[model samples]
Target: MNTNEEHEPRIEVTAPLGERYDEMLSAGALGFLADLHDRFASRRHDLLAERMRRRVEIANGRDPQFMPETAWIRQDLTWRVAGAAPGLEDRRVEITGPTDRKMSINALNSGARVWLADQEDATSPTWANVVEGQLSLHDAICGILSFTSAEGKEYRVTAERTPTIVMRPRGWHLAEKHLHFVDRQGRSLPASGSLVDFGLYFWHNAQRLVDAGRGPYFYLPKIESHEEARLWNDVFVFAQQRIGMPRGTVRATVLIETLPAAFQMEEILYQLREHCAGLNAGRWDYLFSIIKTYRSRGSEYVLPDRTQLTMTTPFMRAYTELLVATCHRRGAYAIGGMSAFIPNRRDPEVTERAFAKVTDDKRREAGDGFDGTWVAHPDLIPIAQAEFDAVLGERPNQLERTRDDMHVTASDLLAFKGAGGEVTLAGVRDDIAVTLRYVESWLRGVGAAAIDNLMEDAATAEIARSQLWQWIENETVTAEGERIDVELVHRLRDEVLGQLPRTASDRFDDAVKVLEQVALRPEYPAFLTVMAYTRYLGETPTTESTTQPETPAQPKSAREHARLVGERDELPIAV
Candidate 1:
């Protein structure tokens, strides 16, 4: 490990370094990260504690309404966020993917206006991925990224029309255990994943990006409140000042994913006004947050199957419409949610139907005045762009179309009562199937899975598992009059495991164990990835030694893997 002899606070990397890892983790970068930790880590802790306190209040029937204290911020309409920084003006379509080498090239060349190079939901936080993803982003920024497949097909970033690169760091809830920082008490604490990602990226490439006519743009994920937005804004300020750049050089677009965040869109944008780009309607995580927040409220709050919860539902409509109006009112862009459909290569009919659905989804967003939309796959890019183009035409955006007709009350946002379609046996099976498969892929170091022609990520798994827990907790009866109890879930789980394809049996078995533990428990875990990280992926500090065990004495389930790591600690009891 390399360290600066003169710096007081040094970054001690517990993870093994890989090729080019040193370049990204230099003393200067690590020192910047440590400085961020020292300045803001305690505030991050307090904010997380605030999140828990709020959740408890909600559990005690304290409904979330617009904060009366921040009423003036919302009522006042003269303020607007800073205008778009370089390379962020015309974001009609943005493609999102992990920052692996090939994906970096494909997404940048995908013809979308912006590429959300994701280190968050779309990436498994393996140590190698954490380090290598930064390397990929750096290479892409310098226009030196290229890849040759094992079959010898070369891929490179096209020189013509490359999309603007906007990095999405991990959320504030997570910690980077691989990077340790010593506190004043001489004790070690995990570095904030958010800081590590943002600090490293900013330290390495902020100037280069600015020199290349783009600023260091980001997509802030999983923020629950405006204070969280304030934390990010403060980080942006410190980072720019530390690196000797302008104050608003770092622009960020916050993802309105959590239900609480949906209610505070204006406040969030207000807090980050100088550094804000806009807001994104993160459809899947938003649903997961709703279910998680209100799971104990009985059937009125119980969501139906994951498949039935479309964006057109009354509650979802209220959320999105309010977001568009809020953004336009504040003079910011309103970006739509992801269309997760991946075209089926073999079946033209399936591809056509999927494209049609995507077209409708994007058209609705365009007509409702969204400046842009998100697509997971390259093929869907043109489909989404065409819809946005039909609405945008020669204009860069439709910020002039202020959606004054929309007014979303708290009750309308909470009107999930019977809005989603009825739960059914097929939905139960699908929930189990998709959750298991997704968890399996995640264990194998893949975060995004193309399951059944849809791009399923961590959010998809969260919604699926949350649905199971909600159903079982509420004793929700399926359309066939079968109660979704623990027994039925276990039965379906075993049956699904039995039906798994031969090649995937071992991984599928591991996935079933994970799904059962998370979904069938008496209390719902806040996030499955958090627990799974402490279990399977936390074995080794780095990816070099942490690849799956070659020969195991027992079945390599996530639980077994945890045991292999000598971690026998009981799962934390949910509050």
Candidate 2:
């Protein structure tokens, strides 16, 4: 054990460093991460434990309600978040994508007001990805980032006015397996992915962003409680103080995606009052959260197919309406959800239809008084911007709209029947195909994939597997009158696998294993990513080790998808 009583503990690089990793993993950066882990890792663990407790309570028929203790935070209408920071104002349209070199440049050149450079759902946290993403952001801020394709095409930031960059780190529930932190007592544990992503970005770019007339901005994800919000606020305060930036220089927009988070929007905002810039309607993950939270309650809590759960669904409508109302009343930006319609170049008709659907979605959001919305492709930027432009001809935002007419209750938010659609054979097949494709792509280092002309991420895969589990547990009857059982799911899974093309690099075999472990297993895993990461992507332990990785209770999934095929029919159904 490398005990250090006189100084801060060390952060050991467990995996072999890749090209230019030295630049990202300098002694100073490691020291900063060590300090962060030493201070807050225990608290993060406790909060995650609290999340599981909440899940168990909900599973046993305890419905979540707005807390009476936090009532003062909601009723005290005098408090408001800090006004929008310099580059965050007038966010009529924002583009979201992974932080690769080409995508980063394209997003910067795209005619949107902000770029959500995502490191969470859209990124697979391979060591190369982790370091290279930080490098891309650093180089972009310094105005020198560029990429040259193998075919000799050069990509650079060509826009005269680029979008304001806001990075989304991994959620608190994840651990960075490649790096281990040694605490003062000579104990080693995996570093928190949240801190590694945030600490690296903030440590490198805080001053550079300030020099360019912007501060470090972020999109906080998977925050379930106001207490989690307070934790992030404290992180921001500590980060800024350490870097000598003024207080509140770091602004964050919390994603109200989880079910528990919906009831505490007001309290969440109050906790991050000094650093809050807005709240986002993370539609896909919100749906997944609903199923994950209440999967065991009963059939009423079971959701319909993912295709049927649209933003216009009654419960979804209530969620978004309440989000806008809460944000505007508190002087924060109400950003709408992403329209995951990617244009198909080979089929102009497909592209045209995609444009039409995106237009209607953005139009509804604009008319509902959202300050802005998100787009996955650059071609949709003009469509989204045009809608917001029609709504606000000369204003930067609709902050004054104040959607006071909205009134939502707990029952309204939990109106699952409102998402009405049958669990048809088509829906089940779609879920299986999508999970296989998305997980395969993830294993091969692509986090965001174009499936059926839509941009799909980890959230999409989570929804697919979660719905499958929920349907099986409830013995859901399909529209075709076939009951969902282990045998039927196995046949569909094999059929989907047979249809997908097999390339030398495709991980379809592993993807199948992942689906079964997460969806077909008797016990529910809280997160499929954890199971996948630990089984396949965790560090290989190539270096000297003082301690083993701490294993948190994780959701089960396949690695190459071949592990549990023969035994599928033997797994018992849980009701």
Candidate 3:
């Protein structure tokens, strides 16, 4: 524990302390978290408020476009991000998975170039998961991470080549209710999940990573605007300084998942240029954001089946094109989205089709000048790598081909009419079934699950539920001429639930309640996980209250953050 911890905000652990939890929730680590919250909590509040304000503007019929105020940053092409840090330069095949022990070993032993240690959408933040996930990373870095099944089978990282690890923390909007922080004025607040995840990972491993010839690298998720990006940059600066590391020792790749972010890609990159490595195409979450943002507008924003809106769709194509162009122009890496096709070992035909689809997706990305792409299963790594190798033989990346020839506009991005497909009864049923199964699994403390031979996480659930709500709001009619309404959704929900197994331990009933609340309600919840977290997982408090609340408590301002500048200040950072 740090000797100076008494002066920091006091951290209270609300959950039952399990085995080895103390190692992660040490006094020094909690002190680091408290300092982070003290410095950035107010700005986080301001940014979230800005997000709500922007959403209201969009709902008032103002379409998102390139901002007029930040044109100078976009017009200036001379600035480049502090390009790829050590162990991150030659990333051609990246595998993304939750940070479970077995999955972590499999991912590291896989021949992928990088492993995205996902703690965000790919992880359900049960108390055990939140603590043990940190333990997994700590052990993995120490080269002792392993797992043993009940049947005596063991899994370990023994491959000749291991992938570099890049951690993805939870987004800014989520709160970690298992932990709380008391400010100097004695106001208790829910801990910011982003701060706790990033602070623990960085505090425990920053020096160790530097010793291993790598730095603390990260993938930032769910950023909606450049101002949020600026907040991240500020946090990175403060964190490195707090750890006594160099100003630019940390590297981050922002996930351009939201629709507003796509319009400000250049500005997002420019804000984090000192620590930015690249931008990733979070395809599923991008679709979810589109539905959530424009769900109230009209039929034009109402999409077809989720299967119909593939990466080749016009709007998706525009998003990716602009991403690659902006990244290459600014000397940053352009990574592709995940292909969530999990292979079936028992069926040869199923595996063959999975390989073909993944190959086609990777082939398109490689042909379009992407630096790398993501795969869910290790079995598909070689397939993705082969496609990228065919395009980039002996070359680390195709950074030289800037692709300045391709130009995309806001109209191209909002071209929902180009995705012409009729919504079908089968599509609605599939969404219902998938959402139910995934939500049940999530409530059971599993974030990543194989459903219908595809690896799915919270992003998939978000898309599914948002589509249901949007279809109901727009009174969408299926190809069979059946109007999608509350009755239809409720009936289909029952039908899907009837088909699912009802074991004694199943949480299907709770899942149904969640589905009804998020999908069948008049007001769309910003995130389904927030509702589930508060209602199910966030019942415990330091004062011994076990009763669940219907909604999450709003964050309160603690104090003002003082801007810190070092010897390497080129621009003033907004705090």
Candidate 4:
């Protein structure tokens, strides 16, 4: 336990402190995180509640439109976000991965202009991972991060020009249960994961990074509204002031990944103008958000196979073009989404096809006026960079190429007609298998996995399971005229399980159970990870008593607590 100011609350560490964890979780850092929670946690809660309320409105047939109230902000064409921070001015290629020590070093040395060290969808939030990720960033900044594989392959940061580091913290809806803070009324609350990640990173490395000619940059993820973007802007302001740094030192790139956010791209950038660097077309999660937002509307909004929904699709094109037009109009870079293809050295045909697809995707983004794009693995960085290079020969970015001809409307954004592909029994089986495998891996503290040569993360699983749920709910008829139903899904699941090797039977079975609980329910869970977290990662505190003590008894250790809870009986499968 660490105490802050006499009037301020103290933070209790319920997780076992590991090597270097103490260095990152010092008293001052904890105090800073606590301050952020005390000030903004409630607002975060309210914003999430508003998300649910807005979902209800959409369910009642209120199609999302650009806000009339924010028309003044959108119409003000003279305003622009702050110019790019040091080392961020030329982000023609950026690589993304978790901030494990090895990954931190490799990404920094990946030759891309920026490395998106992720703590969100690409990371599984085990307690160790959360704390160690912060430590990895700290070390990477100090130029001491390295790794050695089992075969004695030593990896280090050898790039003469390393990528600028931009951290992506967790979203607002999640809480850092490992860290506890007391509120004014003597009620204990979980610290916002967003604050814990941002506060610790900024507190320890802001000055260091600034002195190194780069500052503490970020990628704000899973935001739904300009108000949410405003919340982050305020956070950056307070954190900079709290640490005695300049107000604009913390730069952020917002991911316009939600359906509502697609409509408010300009508004989001406007809200974070002073701190905004750019916006990313977070394409995968954007797809999941579309399905989740319109799940109840009817069959018209239901999406097709995730494989079929390319960036060139009408709705997707509308979203990307609108993003580029909005961003470049405001003097901010419009980054394209991730190209989740990992090269296979042993299979030249697979590698060649993947490279061709990556080349086409990057070429499309570059030609469409995007400043840069994301690559999952280092091997694909050169492929993406070459395309961007050909388009942007001398210029660092295409911010000047504002696509004014892109006249996207609400209908264009929501146009899913002709995009649906054949949904077969094989598709159903694949979805079940991928969703189950992903959930199982997520529970075991792995967030990014390569399944069938595609890098599948939380967003991929979200799309997989959400498609199944949407198809079943709509009784969507497949290409063979087989309508999706609970019985059909079950048959597919069983058939997939039967084909699995005996060694993986138990794990696959548990995954099936989890998929049923989340995807097959009468109502869709907002996030599959949230449900999986409660069931496997950490236990939720009791909501029965209102007048209880501010801080509950501490758990012996986070690992032990997780073990006990994970052993609890699994949720019963829906019949």
- What overall lDDT goes with each candidate model? 0.85, 0.86, 0.86, 0.83
Better of 2 and 4 by lDDT: 2
Q: Give the alpha carbon lDDT tens digit for every residue of 1-575 in model 1.
A: 23333346656899778888999999899889989987888888878777876876786588999999999999998999985888999999999999989889999888889999999999989898899999999999888999999999999988598999999999988878889876554556778889999999999999999999989999999999999999999999999999799899889999999999988999999999999999999999999999888876667788777788888899999999999999999889999999778789898987998899999999999998999999998889989999999999988899998889888999999898858589999999999988998988887788888998899999999899889988987789999999999899989988887887758334676677678667886534578887677566654523323522244465444223322321111112111
Writing each residue's lDDT as its tens digit, candidate 3 over 1-575 gives 34444444677898888888999999999999988988887788778767876876776589998999999998887899998999999889999999989889989998899999999998999888888999999998988899999899999889877888899999988888888877766667778889989999998988898899888999999999999999999999999998789999899999999999999999999999999999999999999999888887777778999988899999999999999999999999999999878789998888999999999999999999999999999899999999999999999999998998989999999887678887999889988988889988998889999998998899999999989988988899999999999899888888888877799999888888888877886646688887777676544412213422233333231100000100001111122
Candidate 4: C-alpha RMSD after superposition: 7.1
Q: Which residue pairs of candidate 3 clash?
A: none
lDDT of 2 by residue, 84-159 (tens): 9999988889999999999999999998999999999999888778889999999999999999999999998999
True lDDT of residue 402, candidate 1 = 86
Per-candidate count of clashing residue pairs (backbone under 3 Å): 0, 7, 0, 0
Least lDDT summed over 10 consecutive residues: which range in candidate 1? Answer: 566-575
Q: List where candidate 2 sits over 4 angstroms from the true fold.
A: 1-7, 538-575
Cα deviation of 280, candidate 1, in Å: 0.5
Which 10 residues in a row give candidate 4 its minimum summed lDDT? 566-575
Model 1 local distance difference test score: 0.85
Full candidate order by TM-score, most accurate first: 2, 3, 1, 4
